[model samples]
Structures are given as C-alpha cells and as structure tokens.
Target: MTTERQFQHDSQGPLRRIVSSVFSIFETRLELIGIELSEEKERLIGVLFLGLAAMMLTMMALITLTVLIAIAFWGTYRWQSLAAITAVYVLVAIVCALRARAGLSNAPNVFESTLAEFKKDRDTFN
Candidate 1:
C-alpha cells in the first residue's frame, strides 16, 4: 500500500508540473497579445488624428484655390475655369482612392509577433 501511494504521488508530481508549465506559457502569450493590442490602438488613434488634420487643411486649400481661380477668370473664362477645376478634383479623388486601396492591401499582418511566437512554440513542441 505504501509503495502504491508513492507511485501515485510521483506520477502526480510530473503531471502537475506539466500543467503548471502549460498555464505559464498561456499567461505569457496572453500578456504579449494584450501589449500588442494596446500598441496598435495607440498607433491607430495617432494616425486618425493626423489624418483628420491633414484632410481639413487640404480641403481648405483646395477651396481657397478654386475660389481664386474662379475670381481671376470671371471676366472671360469663368465656366471653363470651373469645369477644369472639377475635372482636376475628380482625377485627384480617383488617384487617392486607388492609392489608399493599394496601401490597405499591402499592409502588414496584425499581431505578427504573436503569430510568430505561436509558430515557434509549435515547432519546439513538435
């Protein structure tokens, strides 16, 4: 009976250790994910603010330039000037849309480090 109890205890010790180690790895991975998420959130917010400011400034400049052109050519080329401005604006919009689409398509994968860590762990286990 004593030997049997000893054997059970010895088996449980390693099993417990393995469970504990697994939990530790999980905790570490979760913490890493949290950190990456927080960083991404901060970066996104910063980009949002900067992008808003840039858009506002660009809109103001475009409006001012259009008004100036219309006023300067009001005597003879008023309609032509406006039409040309409209065409330019349309071209700019299409180009910007295409560029933005391309940029998004080429963006790096999010949580790259976390994925890499997971792959490393899997490879090590295998």
Candidate 2:
C-alpha cells in the first residue's frame, strides 16, 4: 500500500509542474500587457494636455486682440458707434462658435478606440 501511494504521488508531480508552468506563462503575459496599457494611457494623457494648452492659448490671444481693438476704436465715431461695436462683437461670437465646432470635429476619437481595443483584449483573455 505504501508503494502504491508512492506511485500515485510520483505520477502527480509532472502534472502539477505542467499546471504551474502554464500559470506562470499566463501571469507573465498579463504583466507585459499591463505595462503596455499603462504606457498607452500616459501617451493619451499627454496628448489631451497639449490640446488643452493650445485651446487656452488661442482663447487668450483672441481676448487680447478684442480688447485692443475695442480700446483703439473707443470714442472714434458718433453715438451710433456703440451699435457698430455691438455688431462686431456678435460677429466675433459667431466666428468663435464656428471655430469651436471645427476644433471639436477634429479632436481625436481616442476614447472609443481605446475602449474597443480593451474590450477586445478582455474577451481574448476570457
């Protein structure tokens, strides 16, 4: 009975080793994939920051130019000049709206693509 038990234990040794090896391979692969995902997320955040900075700079420049123009034109015309100034402001607003729409349209659709890729990876692993 002791000899039979020894045979049974010996038979399980290789099976256990194989299972452990398979698990180790899977774990290593998961680690590598996690590293890749983290790098990608960092890159995306950098891009978002750059876009935000550019937008802020553009708005600041626009504001500065508008103020300079208003100051330069102040008191240069009749009382009806206020109406003209109001019209100019309206036009600027419309132009700004169009530019905002264009910028939004051009923005990268990275979120959807990233989500889809992650879902695909998740399904593959599952």
lDDT per prediction? 0.95, 0.75
Model 1 Cα displacement at 23 (Å)? 1.0
Instruction: List runs of model 1 lying over 4 Å from the truth.
Output: none
Model 2 C-alpha lDDT per residue in residues 1-126, reported as the tens digit of each score: 999999999999998997897687667666667776787799979989997998899779867866666677677754455566568778987998999799879986544544565576568668
Instruction: Give the backbone clash total of model 1.
Output: 0
State the TM-score for model 2: 0.50
Q: Write the per-residue lDDT of candidate 1 for residues 1-126, one digit (tens) a residue.
A: 999999999999999998898888879999999999999999999999999999999999999999999999999999999999999999999999999999999999878998998898889779
Compute each candidate's TM-score over C-alphas.
0.97, 0.50
- Among the numbered candidates, top TM-score falls to 1
- Each candidate's root-mean-square deviation in Å? 0.8, 6.1
Residue 122 shift from truth in candidate 1, angstroms: 0.9
lDDT of 1 at 111: 88
Residue pairs in candidate 2 whose N, alpha carbon or C atoms collide under 3 angstroms: none
Supply every candidate's count of residue pairs whose N, Cα or C atoms clash at under 3 angstroms.
0, 0
